[model samples]
Target: MSQQVGVVTFPGSNGDHDAWNAFANDLGVPTRMVDYRETDLDGIAVVVVPGGFSYGDYLRCGAIARFAPVMNAVREFAQRGGPVLGICNGFQVLTEAHLLPGALLRNESLRFHCDWIHVKVENRSFWTSDVEVGDILRLPIAHGDGSYFADDETIARLESNGQVIFRYCDANGAVLDNANPNGSRRAIAGIANEGRNVVGLMPHPERATDPLVGGADGRRIVTAALSALQVAV
Candidate 1:
């Protein structure tokens, strides 16, 4: 049976349809578009918080949406080992909800950056099952408040726990200090929860799932996720 992935749609969510099509059509999986206001969490194996200006990106990208009724259910679902993926502004939401560690702030340049970026898989987290360590891929990134921040101890803790799942790199695959784009420490681009069931990243992988447009590297991620559904934890 195909894995069922739920894509949450907030008031200003812009990537819901794209995420849905990627999982359902491109990846051949069952997917549903869910409203953020809904409370039920039944039958959801995987959840995706797609990118956009949820709640108008006011008072922080995800501060407002964190109180959505569905998030409480989603939090419980995550605690039960359900897979969750957050992208772009969704990444901010995960942090705001404390699902993932660290917080996203304004870019170092204090500007919104939208373009293709190079990312390297740094750890074998749930979202990176098909991505081997050191593997690099290009994906689109569109966000303003994406500078990842955390205390010194927190950064050390994440590193020691193998939670840092992805990092930004140059075209040569070398870590570019301060090219950290979003002022993220250690050039971190993505990360997974300690249990590895939840992941959040700034880049949009769904947008790169087709060769017709640019690349199909993202299919690997969706396919890997389906495989995770079959394996009993």
Candidate 2:
């Protein structure tokens, strides 16, 4: 039997069910819904912080959600080397929690962007081992603050450590200014921690897991996590 995956639902989280469906129905793994107030992970092998306006994006995107009780458990899980994937607003939460490096700022366009964009895989992280470097996946991004920013030293460190997992790119896999939807630094769309166990991205992978909705490219991400967990076990 496939191991259980946990999908965390913050107060305003909107993609929790989408994540659960991707893991349970599409990937054939059992899934558990983890409420933001819950303090335990319940033996889940992997955890996903789905996208949405956590705490209504009040003080900041994820500033408030970072203090949720479930985040403490999520932090503990990541500290123990368990894989955690955060999408969109969830990505912001990861940064606020310091689980992942760098911060997401408002888009250079100063407007909310909601469209399909191509992202090139740059390195093999826990959630991207199934994809080859330079492989482009068309994923939908919906956020007003998707611009990734980090200081020169931190950016250099992340690059040197191979923590950059994805970069916004053209369909032909060219990393160019024209393809950068949110003006992220170095066109980065996703990144992982040094251990590669925690990944955070601005795109909504769960929304693309079903071909009926669009394409199944996002399924590879969930499967990669499952493969990683199985190897660890």
Candidate 3:
């Protein structure tokens, strides 16, 4: 009996199916699409909030979607120590929900950036237990408001508590300003809650699950999460 994954799909979300395929087909895991209007999360061991322009990206990247009914359930799930993974726009939503710290601001470049990028693992969390710190992962990012911003106090807390889970880096594992595509503070690419059960990132791991598209580094994340949970994959 494998733990089932729930991928939430809000209106205007475009990456729900992609995430579903990654888990259900590529990772050989069971998945259910939790609807936006539904406030149920029974039997979902893990919740995935995939990337997309939710609610037409109005007001802010995730401000509107944060009020969705499904997110309320996801928030409850996270509070109960359930694992949650948010990618791209999903990351924005997590921030809006306050499940993860820091806010995603408009890119300094003031333009949408869509490209394959490298992010170094900064700390291990529930979803990244199989990966070690300093490990560089290749993935894709697409967003206009992906820059991460946090108050000094919050930044200090995240740094001291090891909540910063991912940082942009080069191939040789060097964190450099040039490698930061979104101009996020300290090149932060991802983060985890204090409990480490909830994680949020701006890159699209769901897009890199197959080598046919590019590389398979994304599959490593899926494998790591399932393995960490003692779920057979």
Q: Give the count of colliding residue pairs in each prediction.
A: 0, 0, 0
Rate residue 71 of model 2 by lDDT. Answer: 94
Q: CA lDDT of 86 in candidate 3?
A: 96
Instruction: Kindly list the per-residue Cα lDDT of model 2 for residues 45-140, writing each as its tens digit.
Output: 899999999999999899999999999999999999989999999899999999998899999999999999999999988889788887899999
The candidate with the higher lDDT, 2 or 3, is 2
In model 1, the clashing pairs are: none
Q: Residue-wise lDDT of candidate 3 within 42-137, one digit each (tens)?
A: 777888999999999999999999999888789998998888999999999999989999899999999999999999999989878867887889
User: Rank order by TM-score, top first?
Assistant: 2, 3, 1
Model 1 Cα lDDT, one tens digit per residue, 86-148: 989889999999999889989988989988888888888778888888898888888888888
- Clash-forming residue pairs, model 2: none
lDDT of all predictions: 0.86, 0.91, 0.89
